[model samples]
Target: MSDFTQRFLFDDFDARGELVTLEGSYRHVLAKHPYPEPVAQLLGELLGAAALLIGTVKFDGLLVLQARSTGAVPLLMVECSSAGELRGIARYHAEQIGDAQSLGELMPNGDLAITIDPANGQRYQGIVALDGANLADCLSTYFATSEQLPTRFWLFADGQRACGLLLQQLPVDRQKDPEARAASWEHVVTLADTLTAEELLSLDSETLLYRLYHEEAVRLFEPRALQFRCSCSRERSARALVSLGREDADQLLAEQGGTVVIDCQFCNQRYPFDAADIAQLFAGGGVEPASDTRH
Candidate 1:
């Protein structure tokens, strides 16, 4: 199935939920880098988590989820835009990774960070220690500690696909009956906890929700498409070189035989700057190469 995120509201509960399944997008991220099995699985989970978290807010830019540690896997990060474009990368010691399966094992003393960068406003970031057994638990701790919200997550990823479910308790309003709302929240979460990883990965949103909340008043929103897209371009790459200052750029070009190469880690796309390209960039002109050369 295509990658998509489905939002839902509980008519009987003061809560919200999101279900996301990523197949094509997940595979696209894996294709860009040959991540080891453990790293690939972790990247997939982060990708799903980023997408689900972005849907929780109304923003116009990018949401980034990052984890850093002093372990086999030093860093793993994923970014999802408001428009559903996604990209991710992971850095790890291949031999040190071994057969570790949980977040604690992969990142011994790690910290999780979530950042929201809007197009026209200040960025917001929150950090939490990675004290949970798995990624889902780590994120749950983030929500409880950072947002002060009762949030739960079920995340699963193999090398092939990634899937996630997010459940959050909505803010209480004076008009609503507090006891009723609290009861409903508990009911929904209890049912959600029964979901198995296999069912989450294989079932569609509609079927999955029905199977879990068939008796409840659950309203599922239309699925939004999620895609694998890199925001990298020759222009952006050229601008980066210009920022290094004219003299440094020229020296680098000379050292590399009049050609400077920049590779995007997210998409594995290479941008080569020859003398003409470098000259145009330094002259405050656009990069208009004769042919598109990508490696």
Candidate 2:
């Protein structure tokens, strides 16, 4: 019911913030996959984090956050486009996932990788070894080493819900003293770090800010809407089949009743393409094949 995202700016400080409450979006993501409890919780948090990260970006791009593990949860990936659409999926061993408590326990020696692809420019990537016990710290490392920006994050996800808060420092005017900018950024991060997961997901923007920054003059911005959306289609699937080469595609088509069945791992949407679909793909060229976005 209360499924929306809000972006707020601190009026008197050189700082901005974002808060996301996920209900319908979270449910829609989970409905497609029967993930284990631990994996599900991690996916929810990653999904929220991805949305928060993408919303702040100015250009039309895709923002991806991934957790790679050598343990039960081999890999967890979440993607958010510039339009505020999101999709995610996880891979894990069910037996190993049993009785797992924390994300660290499930993803030992894990790391976080973030990639940004602008619509008209080249993509960029940053990676950091998993150093903290939770997603927040992992992301903290990213901000410190990758962007060098003073940033803070609060992430929380139970078996049912997921939410996050982000605060970042903004550049100051040339006439403004450098010390003033540093101090403002430091103060914002300190207050933001004091936020708890319960407070982040449960309280409204006004109440949460009052609790954290009661002493500072804070300005809140209009909220943004975030939801679950899958970018999948029949033509996309057919193009993918064409990439498999004609011989392989025909053999598979012969074995499977002349149809290729493709399912979207992110949303579980199924696309069925018969021989005729394959013929059209090769005949009418120019449609690019669906490439893997996870790399």
Best by TM-score: 1
RMSD of each: 2.0, 4.8
- Model 1, residue pairs in steric clash: none
Tens digit per residue, CA lDDT, model 1, 1-295: 4899999988767788999999999999999888888889889989999999989889899999989999999999899999999999999998887778778898998998899999999999999888897889889888777757798999999889899999999888521887787787788889999999899999888899999999978899999999999999988998899999989999999999978999999998988988777777777678877335432
- Per-residue alpha-carbon lDDT of candidate 2 for residues 58-108, written as tens digits (9 for 90 to 100): 889789888898999989999888888888888989989778868778999
lDDT of each: 0.89, 0.79
lDDT of 1 at 38: 80
Lowest summed lDDT across 10 adjacent residues in model 2 is found at 286-295
Return the TM-score for each candidate structure: 0.94, 0.89
